[model samples]
Structure formats: structure tokens, C-alpha cells
Target: MARIISLEDVLKDQIKEINQLEMVTSFIQNKEELKDSLIQAQNDIEDLSIGVLGLKKDLEKMKEHNVSQRKLMALYQQLDDRIIHMTNNFPESLTQQLDRQEEKLNPIIKEKTPNSYKKPLAIVTNSDLTKCEPIITGDSIVKDCRKMLFKDPEDSYIIKELSDSEFSKIPKYMIGRQTLSTVNAFITTINQIMKFKYGILALGKVGARKKGELNLYLEFKKEESDLKAANQEGEIYFFNADDYERETNSKLDKTKLNLLTVLRHCKRIHEIRLGKNVKYRVITS
Candidate 1:
């Protein structure tokens, strides 16, 4: 007797294995379906958010146009009323003629009147900022600004003084122009741009002789809010230079530090020598 196998018992074991396999297959199918559903749901949410924003803009435009229509209608009605008032003293026949003309004019006016004074416009168009300007980001500008101002990002931030030539380098970074006049305006503009784009006061120039410097000192801070000085010797101060008729009121010295002041600081270089592209037979030495 070799365990006395029965057909009914063997059939029962096989049925149980088949049921387990079916369950595993169903589970895998459900997992993939769930993933697809999640992706679809995420896309639907983004679409809905964009639609809601578009609806808000359209509402504003509708309101503005409606108000404009009301204004035009009011003006037309006022003119009609004025004409009627003037003709009150005239003959009844003439006044009746004016009334009839007014009735005819009202329909024509309504047809000719524009909802807005400007050209007919469609509803507010969608403008998605993320879809455009992949280049004008903080990551790129910060490095350029840091490199231009400090030369080295990790270097000390204590650039206490800058001559007129040194100060002139800031305008192109701020407004992308080299025609800005006065050192006072240059620093102010650069700080304004930095504040809006970077959300911090990046630089400050102080020209107070009563305290210390006769020229503008380029004080770069990490943030808009006041921060502790990086070192004990570095103390920040301010004064009104216009009232002081002394050295502080005098303009920053235009003396450039080096011969490279006139150079536009281009990145690419072009140079050639007669030594190159020449062939000579070597004589035995």
C-alpha cells in the first residue's frame, strides 16, 4: 500500500492550488489599475486648479466691462433728458417730434455702443508662469551676482570700501546698462532689484565722514533684516551726506585701481602669434 492515493483527494489538492494562483493574479491586476487611477486623479486636480484660476480672471473682466456699459448708458440717457428739458418751452408739436426721435435714437445708440471703449476683447486668457522662462531663475542669477561682487563666494564679505570705478561695475548687474549716473543712484537701484528678485537687501553703500569713510563703502548683507556683524571690527553706520558740506558730500574719487578698468570684462579671449602656423626645417645643431 503506497499511501493509498484517491482520485477525489488528488482533485481536491489541485483545486486548492488553482484557487491560490487565481487570487495572486487578481491582486497584481488590481495593483496596476490602482496606479493608473492615482496618476489620472493627479492630472485632474492640476486641471481643476488651472480652471479655477481662469474663472477668477474672467469674472474680473466681466465686471469691468459691465461697469463700462453702465457708464455709456448713463451718458446717453443724460443727453436725452437734457434735450427734452430744453424743448419743454417749445411748441407741443416740436416736443412730440423730439420724443419720437429719442425713441428711435435709443435703439441705434444701444447697437452702436461698445461694452468697453477699447477694441473688443476676449475673456481673460490663461497665463501659466511655470510654462515659460526656464532660464531667469534664482540659481543662475545668484552665482553671477556673487561672482561679480565678491569674486569668490566663500571669500570674506567685508568689502568695506569701493572707489568710483569699483562702484560703476554694479549698474550692468542691476539694470543691464552702463549709463547710470551718480554712485548714490547705482547702489540704490541694485538694492531695489535685489530686494524684489532675491527678497533681501543685498548691498548698502555708506558715505559718512563724521563716523569714518570719506567715500562709499559697499556693505553686503545676507538678509533684509539686520544681522550681527561678521567680525568685531565691522560696525555698520549711516548719515545724511547732503546736509554735511564736508568730505562726505564730496563725490567718490574716480581713480580706478588698475589698468583693466577700461576693459568690459569679456569671457572669451582671442589672441594669435606669428610663432603659430609656421613651419621651419630644423638645421643640425
Candidate 2:
């Protein structure tokens, strides 16, 4: 268009070229922004891959820890089973050894312990009489029997010779106050002789007294009379130190002869004190 193109046409052509150049510059800028977007997306994908690998490594470690725990549980179960088996099947020799050990320790333990055996009882028998002399002599039997009766004057018994019908025929009061005494005295005499011969102190003083002698006849005269009536006929047979000396036929000191001491050794007699006088009694039964 060197052949003198119109001015309007030239201006139009220049405007079209400027529009194309502006479009080209815009496309170049858009291409550079797209390249930067692609680089950022690649970096994000690489970081995601690294995080997945770390998660896989942690899962493997957890699996290994679970296996170790299972192994430990199995070991504990095996140990418990072994302990149960050992307890249930213990050897007999071990049990015998334990019993022997206990027996060995028993004597040592007993050495420090107190005696617990039962005390032997004193049993008097006919065999014992055969070995010992009679405590009461035949001469002293009557005196000893009288002493026993005086001590418990109120106690009286019916004669075995008298039948129940015969005893009943007599008045009850008369039987108790009159006839009973003679029967009692007779029975007591026989019993005393047997006790002396057998060497048995069955009715004698069982234990010692604190006082040598004490007033025993505390009953009134009327009471004594009633007791005498209940046990004896007519007058009561009262004995003293003189009577005992006469009966025993031993001239030993009368004061030294404590009736209680004699009663302790004797099988048939007891003593009571009435005012200043000493009375003796026989033990029946």
C-alpha cells in the first residue's frame, strides 16, 4: 500500500495490530501463572506420599507389639499350669519328712509346757487294810462309838432286826425318841469295828481344823434333852477326857490327846465340847 493508501485506512490497520499485540502479551502472562500452579500441585502430591509411608511404618510397629504381648501371656499361662501340677502331685516322702520334723519339735515345745496329767486319786480298799495295822483297837471300840453318837445325837436309825410292821406298831415319836438310839448305837458299833479292821477312815475327819478345839455344844438343855430322847433311851451317855483315858487304857497326857487329831486318824469317832466338858460321839454309816 505504498501507492498512497488513505489516512483512515492506515489508522485502522495500526489499531488492529495494537489489539493483536495486547492479546499476545495477555496469553504469555496466563502461560506463566499456569506453570506456577502445576509446580505447587506436584509439591503437595510428594508431601501426601511421605505422610502415607509414615502411617504404614506405625501400623507395622503396632502389629509387632501385639505379637510380643501375646507371647508374654502364653508364658504366664504355662508357668501357672506348672505350679498347679506341682501342688497337686506332691511326693509322699515330703509329707513324711514334714511329720518327722513336727515330731522332733514336739518334745522341745513340751519342755517349756506345764504338767497337765490328772492327779492320782486316793482309793482305800481291802488290799490296803491287809498292808496296814488297825487304827482303832478292840478295847477302844465302845468309847469311839459313843463319841461318834454324841457328836450327832439327833440322828437315829431303826434296828434292822425290827420289821417295818413292828416299827410302825410302835408310836412314831417313841420310835424316833427311844428305840432309834439303841439301834443307831448298835449299827455304829458294828460299822466302827469294820472300818478299823479295814483301815478305812471313811467317816473320819477328812481335813484339818484351824482351831485345836472349839465349843460345839451350843444347843440349850431342852434341845439337848430332845436330841437325847430322839437318839437314846433314858439318860444320854456323855464321855470326857477321863472316860477316853480309861477306855484307851493309855496313861498318856489327856491334854495332849486332841480329840480332833485322834478323830483324823481314827475311823469311827468325833468330839464335841459342852461348856468346859468334852463329849465324844460315834459315826454310824
Candidate 3:
């Protein structure tokens, strides 16, 4: 076995060693490339995670903004409703104030007007009239007159004079004082007068040359319609008893047709007093 050494054999052994070294070097280079690829993949994953986090935060902000917008819209709606309510009610409030001021100045106005120019007026009260009929027919006559007046409109001047004449027939003391009994009696008398004096013309069934005299009747009819409409819509319609009496040439007692009794009987009616003036309304459901 420890035989003769050959130079060719030694050279072949040296060449095998060189091939093995080359294989080791190739394996090291491959290991380094694989490590670099792993590091790059880790960095990419981290970047993706950061991007996802940012998107989540943005989504949260957008949700908050949407909620804020909804709240703002609700506030705007409330403001709009308030404005509409004010607009609708302002004119009536102003008119009431003006009427009060006029009442305060009435004595001065009467004094200024000459006695000769002032016409002799017939002042009547609801209490002064007697009820001859059990049923009140004035309601139907009022409605009919309104329809007729609207059918053929007349001059404002003539209408004003007629209205003034009717109002003058009511006494100053009894203008605001009304009782249910008195009102009923007054209505009965009015119905009787309309039927006996005017006949078919009382309900405006026939045309007349004095159409302007029906202006007050038309106004009352309109008011009744307005009250009915308001009640249907679940709203309240109110008026001052004194102002109503003056306009309609009627009187009422303190107990019978008083605001409280009317409210109790009608169910829809409500009462409130501002100073001396009593305000009534048929409330909404």
C-alpha cells in the first residue's frame, strides 16, 4: 500500500481540491443574495402596514365630518321653521298693538269730530234684543251673504260706509261685554230682522243695488271659514271679544258666552288674556 508515488496522480488530486473551493464560493454568494431578498420583503410589509393605518385614520375623520354635517342640517331646519312662524304671526301681533293704540286715542278723535257732522246713531246691545225663535238662522244667512258678496264685488268706499253704519248701531259700553245668553238672543233677533225686512234678499238669494252693504257680512263669513280651516289643520284661531263685538254690532254677558264657557262647550276653543283684551283660539289637535 505505501507504494511508489506518481507525479500525475498528485496533479489530479490538486485539480479536485480547486473544484471543491469554487463550489464553496458559489454557495456563499447564493446565501448572501437570499438574505438581501428577505430584508427587502420585510420592508415592503412594513410600508403596507403604515399605509393601512393612515387609511383607517382618514376613514374615522370622514365619519366624524358626516355626523357634523347632519347636525348642521338639523339646525338649519329648525331656524327655517322659526322664521316661518315669526313671519306668519308678526302681522297679527302688530295689528293688535295698533288697535290698542287706536282705542286709547278714541276719545280725542271723538272730541275733534264736529257734533253737526256726527250723524245720529242708534246704539243697540245683544242684551237689549229678545230672542223670538229657538233656532238661530243668522249663521246660514251670513254664509249665504258671503257667497253673494264674493259673486259680485262692490266699491270699497260704499262698503266702508255700510260697515261703519252697522258698527254705529252697537253701543260703546256693550262692545266687549258679551254673554252666551245675550249672544243667542242677539242672533235670534238678527235672524228675524233679516227674514222679515229683507225677505229673499236677506240671505243674498236675490241681487240688489245696495251690494256694498254686505261687506261686513262677507268679512264675518271669511273669518268663520278661516277658523274652520285652522281647526282642521290642528291649529288655533283666536280673536278679541271686544273687537269682535264692535265689528259685528253685538253684546255679550260676563258668564254665559264668556271665553271660559265657550272654550268648555266648543272643545276646540282656548282663551288667553293680554292686559284687558281677551284672546280666544280654536286650538289645533
RMSD each, Å: 29.7, 36.2, 25.5
Where is the poorest 10-residue window by lDDT in model 1?
A: 276-285
TM-score of 2: 0.24
Provide the TM-score for each candidate, comma-separated: 0.22, 0.24, 0.24
Give lDDT tens digits, candidate 2, residues 42-111: 9999999999999999999999999999999999999999999998999999999999999898765433
Winner of 2 and 3 under lDDT: 3
Model 2 lDDT, full chain set: 0.49
Output the TM-score of candidate 3: 0.24
Give the winner by lDDT: 3
Separately for all candidates shown, the number of backbone clashes (residues 3 or more apart, or on different chains) is 0, 9, 11
Off by over 4 Å in 1: 1-29, 89-285
Off by over 4 Å in 2: 1-28, 92-285
